[model samples]
Each structure stands twice: as structure tokens, then as C-alpha cells.
Target: MMMTMATAAAVAVEDSTTDDVQPLSTLKMQAAQVAMDSGAVIHASPDVLGKNGEDSAWVTVNVTAPSPSAGHWVALFSPADFGYGLPSYLLVYMFANVSPSFMSSGSGNLRFLVINQRSDYAFGLFSGGKDNPKLIAISNKVSFANSKAPVFPRLSQGKEWNEMAVTWTSGYNINEAYPFVEWKMKGGESSKRTPAGTLTYTRRHLYSYQIGHELPDGTVVWGKSSTFRASPFPGQDSLQRVVVFGDMGIGQRDGSNELAGFQPGAQVTTDRLIKDLPNYDAVFHIGDLSYSNGFLAQWDQFTAQIEPIASKVPYMVASNVVVLCRCSGNHERTYQDTGGFYNGNDSRGECGVPAETYFYVPAENRGKFWYAADHGMFRFCVGDRCFSSVDRKHQPWLVFAAHRPLGYSSNDYYATEGSFSEPMGRTLQGLWQKHRVDLAIYGHVHNYERTCPVYENTCMDGKSKQDKGSYSGAMGGTIHVVAGTGGAKLRDYSAGPSPQWSVVRDKSFGYVKLTATDHSSLRVEFIHSDDGAAHDAFDITRDYKDVLACTVDSCAPHTMAN
Candidate 1:
């Protein structure tokens, strides 16, 4: 898939526990005291799964204890040897109360969805609730047909417009197997192989490819085949669609992990994206992806959840086009005294390791977390560490994309701070105005919000008599959009009156789709995930001259000598 471009600066507010805490953190595993009940039993079946090469499977778990209570719970652990592993990744956990009759009957059957994360799994029954979990019984080991089979093949635009990069995860190392992508032009007779680390030129043609690992014996273990249309040439006039959203943590299809009320909209948004896969070309998950926080196992779950859309299209967690501009979000990079701008322990101790290691973006230094990418007529200066400098003559749409809203928002959290945005949110105001950025999109607020062309807290268009739905001619100021509505619990707008520049706010599960009909017209729509309908939209209509025209403080210095 074609990861695109964006740019911005990092300025964050400390997130509240209600919004950013990882679910697993509620469990005090370190203090867990084993209270074995010989008569109590926990069993999971069928003992095997994924016989058809499926990546995920649903299993039924039956548990019985001497005295079932609200405190009793069940957890799925990976590596099958959770006893000795000081910190085992818990794949999923749920209270026995969810079974409805467990409290009275002392036994109940629950269902769980498990994925091929290249590991073995087991279910454990525990008592004493989350604060003081007690292991009672363990289920027999459950395994997939091929636990180490290559899975979750993600695509990113390569360093060049014509190049594409495919990355995946597997159990085999170089000595055991060689990883490569087998590709062919759509319907072509012959196919070619590109080894891992080598770029494959797909250009603009429709191509089909599959990830595989060649074993020492020369036998090939292949993943499912998928197709993607290559990115159009930069500056090309063609219809382009890109999806942007943030804070979408992993969704529990089996209904586990609901106690925390985290990310209720995640699965629906994911389903909407999958259903509308044919309509858009690429996706940008701006930040707070997976909400994994610190439990590393959730990363696998997040990847499994997004594989359907990502494996087939260009799903960018970082890159917008060619540049990987990033300042890791609190959940991805922050830890106490970790040198991050924020002093929160939101990352639990992850400190950006999993995020930097898991995803591939074309960053000069992956640790810095920022880069640039181009898609047709759109120029994305996507990073949070600094401002992006771009020539707007060819790609008129200069966008600043980040995980946090550095532009404008009216969420209650920021509203109370009296800034209506993150602390130091507008520190980059001068840079944005100087670059004439058309739109700045962000994802930390957990709600939908849009601003009219605004600068310095003033609505540039409100005074110009410009229509709200359609903007034409020179964009006097950048339009800021907060689309953190990609799952996670939705937040409410400020109880106070809406700011004049805050044109719209919707507490719904949805994403923003930017459709560039051509070089001169861009349409942005906030599509609700529940019904796959656009609840709000606006269009920007302008000519190349309008882009070059002076806007507030963005005009070049005048020279009479010329």
C-alpha cells in the first residue's frame, strides 16, 4: 500500500487514566498468588485450530470452580509456559461473570477469538479479581496448524514512487528460511521474486503478490495472495482517496476486555473500512494505534485485527507518502523520565520500542519518528518533531498530520485548560501560516471536530463570507480537523459554547476521507463507521494562482525592483 506524507510539531497534554490506561494494567500479575483448586478445572477446545491456514479461530472455553464469583476470571496466555516466563503476554482476559450463569452454576462456557501470532496459547482460570489474581487451573495447550507460519504482511511505499516494500512476521530466521515476496503483473503469465530488503518496482500497474519463506529444503511456505494498485506519479491529476483516523485500539470481536469500556468503536470502524476497501486507495492511522500501552502481546492482536485491510491496501501507521514524520504518542513512546516531552507512564515501559520495531517507514532515523511522502497531487509533511518545508506549486494540498491535535479542538479536556487544545498546541502556528498548509488533521481527542480556515484562534473564512461547506479561492488559513474518532471511547465536546472557528463536532465512531478529484479540488468527508455514510463533508475549490496568492502572513516579501 502507498504510505503518504504529512508534517506537524509535537505538543501533548497529559492524558487521563480513563482515556489512556491499558486494560492489562488492571491485573496485578506480579502480586498474583496461586490458589489451586484441585476440583476446579478449565478446558479449551478444539485442541487444534487453523487447519485451513486461517490466521484466526474462535474457541469455546469451559471453566468450573468450587465457588464461582464475580472475582473469578479467565485469561489467555501465550508461549504455553506462563509459569516460568516472568512476563508472559496475555492475549485476552475476561471475567467469568460474563458467562451469565457462572456465578450461580459454578460452570459456564465462554468463547474467545485467537489468532496465529506465531505462538502457542493456554487458558488459565484465576480468582480474586484483577487486583489480586489467583491461578486455579490451566487448560491444555492449543496450537495452530503452523504456529510459525508467516502472517500479517504489511505494505509500505518504498523510497521511490515506483518502489514498494512488503514486511511480514514469522518464526523462521535467515539460516532456517529465506523470506521473499513473489509478485506478478495482474494476469501476467510469468512471476518474479524479490528477496526481503530488495525493492520491487510496481509503478502504477495493478499487481498481485504473496509473501513466502523458502525453507532449507527449497519448499515454500506461502501466505494468502493479495493485490494493490501502485501509487500514481507525483503531480498526476487523478482521483485519489485516503483515509485518516487515530486512537483506534484493538477491537475484541469475541467480546472480551469490555470491562474497561475501551475502544467500543474499534471493531465497527474496522468493519466499515473492510467493507469500503474498494472505494479508497490508502489509509493513515495517525496515532495511538492498538492502544497496546505496554502489554506487548496486544501488538500481535492489533496486527491481526488490521491484517484484512492492511494486507490488501496501503495502511500507514506512520508514513503518509515517502517520509516517516513522527513523534511517538504517549501510548507508544512515553514513560516516566524517558526523556519524552510528556512525563506520563502511558507506555508502561515500552518507551517506543515496539512501535519502532514493528512498523516500517522511510525515516532517515527511525528513532526520531518523522519523514515525508507524496501521493499524486498531495504533499504530506507528516512529522511531529518539526515543521516540513515543501514546494506547493505541484502538490497544492499541504497537510500536517499528527497523533495529537496541534491545531484546534473543543474537547472537554482541552476546554477546561482554557486553550481549547493541547498545551503549546499552537506553538507551530507561525510555521503553519508561513507554509500555507491547507489542512491540519489530528487524532488524540476521541471525537470529531473541524474548524473553518483559522489562524490565531480566529476564523479566517467567517469574516470573508466564505461558505462553510464549500471553500473557494485563496485559503486564508489552514482548516484543522480532529478525527480521533477511530474507535476508543468517544468523548464529548466542551460543555461551553462552541468556538466560532469550530465549525462542527460529532461524538461518533468514524474516519475522515480526503478525496482529491483533481489538483484543484479536494473533498473531505467524515464517514460514520456504523452505517458507512458520510455524516459531514466539505470541499475546497481553488486554482493554482489562488494557492500562490497571499494569505494572512503566508505571502512572500514584495520586491519593487522585480
Candidate 2:
């Protein structure tokens, strides 16, 4: 059952404190003064009061704390309930400290103890030092059991405001899921209540709290307070925006490099991109990410190269033919030929070399090389560069992406078909017509091209386009786009009247940004790396009224392409 917040009767504390604790008062005064200096405001009361019988209180405080330092404290206690056994949750946010591990540096601290109850278990945020802000868990009332540390680009300093939040998902379910407590220390050591045994949480009934912190002696200070219940899927409410491109091998075609005209080889340029990555939840690698040539060392370097970006977002991939061809016929060839497949098996293999790691799709779709995932209003259909059969199931949304384009110009000597050709055009075109995929993306052309919505070589008029296509009114007429211009060598465009189906084509190094505003409208823009210019863009809208409604027989295979 879904959980909802209940309005519990508020019970004001009668005595306020069991005993007038001088040390606690002193600490509060010092924190308040420091917060005032740092331009922060401290509320005199709790930010949130627990519901009746729910034993929990959250208070926000201001501290004028220096950054990169540690050891500060805040206290929380319920006046109505003094005994233990009734568990509660807490969450804190740091509004000032941006240091890598500000939590431990005393940027923000929290302390809570059951007046009469023994602590069971606890899970929330903590910072060990300037380098160790981690999500820690304690069990069995002993040592730290689990921790997830943040991987920041570099140590942070200054009065930059940052936030540290904690949520306790379970308090009861002792023995089954142990109870715990979390607290910040006055000096440096942070404390957490340990559980008697192991604990596991099925439904996340997270109780949240937030507060603000400040430091005066150059000690790290942060501010925070509970906001609202966050969505289980972070970033889901935002439109699913993704930058798709591939074949980026270190350098660029234009004088400026990756990320739209950023200076070539400028570390800050890449850093900026990494820092801004949270704006988008995922990325699609059409192919040729590192030009590693199946060399484990190169692959390692490649991974390291994109660590700044990959560490934060979901990096999805399609295969690159060059990576495949280079390793072909060698002992390494067997292992690298497939997208992480081994000996004809779908499972990933350790091909004796670090570069032998295979590319596996997300686990949700059976880890098949091809799969589909819906982000907000748009559904992305990712296909394996090698397998066409996977396209059968998800054909309706077969907005295919791979290293090679089914249709291409002959300007490049390698554009012709050979033994490796799988006739993707014939198969995908039939399927596109049957299911009417909205868009197909590919790399390997080493350039960029946007095709008019087309099927069987015929341009689809906007008026003729259907809102619901074969896959529920969810899909529209399919358009194919190529965005391989990510620093790799550039290829000349195919000479001619540019197929009637071609809408926009460019040889500049760049990336494509896709924005889905709703079920029927999508906006795509091509940003050039040469001048940070938006070279081309277009809007594709579906007329839901034109979509053929699905029926038992209408949804059959005959209605779809084989």
C-alpha cells in the first residue's frame, strides 16, 4: 500500500528539557552566532514536529562554519515522548559547505538519542573527513556496516552552499529489519544507533529532516531542512533529454573539441560538462567510444577519460565496427567480436584481456544487447549493432541506434556492403513501416544527417503521419538521424540531390540533443563542436487522432513487419 503523510496532533513540550543542559545551550549559542556571520538564519523551533505517537522532531539551525573543517553539532529530542523503542527518522541538508566531505568536517551535524529507549539500527548520511562524505549504515550496535561515498571531481572549498540530506527508511521491524539512529558530534566523531541484527527494507517508508549549518573558524559549514517527499525515481519528472553521438576518439574535427566548441584538450571544458550532467539522466553512445582497438590499456584509459561523465549518468552504448574489425581474427578477436558476448553465449566473458569487457544492455530487459526503456513521455529503443531479431519484440518503438547506418552515401570508401552486411535497411525498413518507429539513430558515418520521416524510401508528410502508429498511439512515423561527429575523423557528404529523404546533413563534429516535451511533440537540435552553433533542428509531432486504434487482430504479427 502506498504511504501518505498523516496530520498527528501537535504536543508542545511542557518542560522543554529534562534538565537545563548548559553545554547544549552553549553549543546552540555558538552555532547561532556563527550562522549569523555567514549570512544564515537560524529558526528557534523545530522545522517539523512528529505526529502523535510517532516520536520525532526536526529542527533547523544556522552555523557560521569555515569550509574544509570538521566538528559541529545539533541536537533533536521529542518532549512529549521520552522513552525508547519507538523509532523515528531524520534528514539534514547542508546549504553552504561544498567540500568533498563536509559532513565530517563539521559542516553539518545531528544528534538524537532515545531518552529511555536503546538504539537499534540507523541509515543516513555522514562525512568521515574532508574526503569521506558517505551514506553509512550501522547494525548490531557495533561497527560501520555499509557505506556509499560521494565521488566528486575535486575537493571543494570556499563559502559555496551545498546540501547533505538523510532519510531513515526503517525504524521498527527489529530482528527482521533492525532499528537504528543517526547523530552528529560536537567535536568530530559522528554517532549512529546500531541494530541488534540484520535489517532489510522492502517498501521505503523514509522519514525526512533538514537543517542549516555554519562554521566560523574556516571549518566546513552547511545548511539544510526537510523539503518534501522526493520521487522514488530521481530526475523522472524532468523531460528526458539526452545527447547522442559516437566515434569520439580523444581529438576533434574542428579546431575546438568535444562539448560544442570547448577548447581542445581543456580539462575545464570536460569538467564543466561533467558537472552539468545531472541535468540529464542518461546518454546514448552510438559507437566507438574510445578507439581502444580492443587494447585493454586503451580501454582503461577510455573509461578513465569519461569517468567524470560516466560516474554520474547512465552510459548506454551501441557497437562500433572499427572496434570490431581491429580485433577480428586475433585471439582477442573472438572475445571482442560480440558486444560482451562469449563463445556464442549471451553472458559476459573475461577475454583474458581487460579490453575484452563486453557491452551488456541494462539488466531489466534480460540484458539482451537490444532493449527499450521509457523515460517520462518518451520511450527509447536501443538495438544491438549485430542482432536484428531483438527488434521483433520492441519493433513498435524501434527507434534503432547502432554504429552503422543502414542507408548511407558512398563518399566514404567503406560505405559499401560486404560479408559483414546484415541488410539492416531491408529488415528495419519493413519493421519501421509495420510498427512506424518514431526515430532511428546511428553513428559510424563520422558525420551528422537528419532524415525526413520516411518509410520504404517514401517521405512521410506531416499530415499523413499518424499519432498512434502500430504500437498503441504511442509511436509516430519514423525518422532516421546520424550523429557520429564526436571528434573522430570526418567524412565528406555523399554528392547528389541529397536523397529526397535527407532533411539536414553536416560534416562538422557535433552532438544531437533530443528533448521530449510530451507524447506527441519532440524537439531535436544539433549543436556543432566547431563554433558552439546550433546547426540544425526540427520538431516532430504526432496526431494521435490519426493513429489506428489497436484491436486483438490488428495487433498481430501480420500487422507488424516480420
TM-score of each: 0.92, 0.46
For model 2 the TM-score comes to 0.46
lDDT of 1 by residue, 212-265 (tens): 889988899887788888887778888899899988888888888762388888
Per-residue lDDT over 483-531 for candidate 2, one digit per residue giving the tens place of the 0 to 100 score? 7676655667654456565667787777787776544556777877645
Q: Considering every candidate listed, which one attains the maximal TM-score?
A: 1
CA lDDT of every candidate: 0.78, 0.38
What's the residue-level lDDT of 389 in candidate 1? 51
Candidate 2: deviation at residue 314, Å?
1.6
Quote the positional error of residue 334 for candidate 1 in Å. Answer: 1.6
Count: clashes, candidate 2:
47
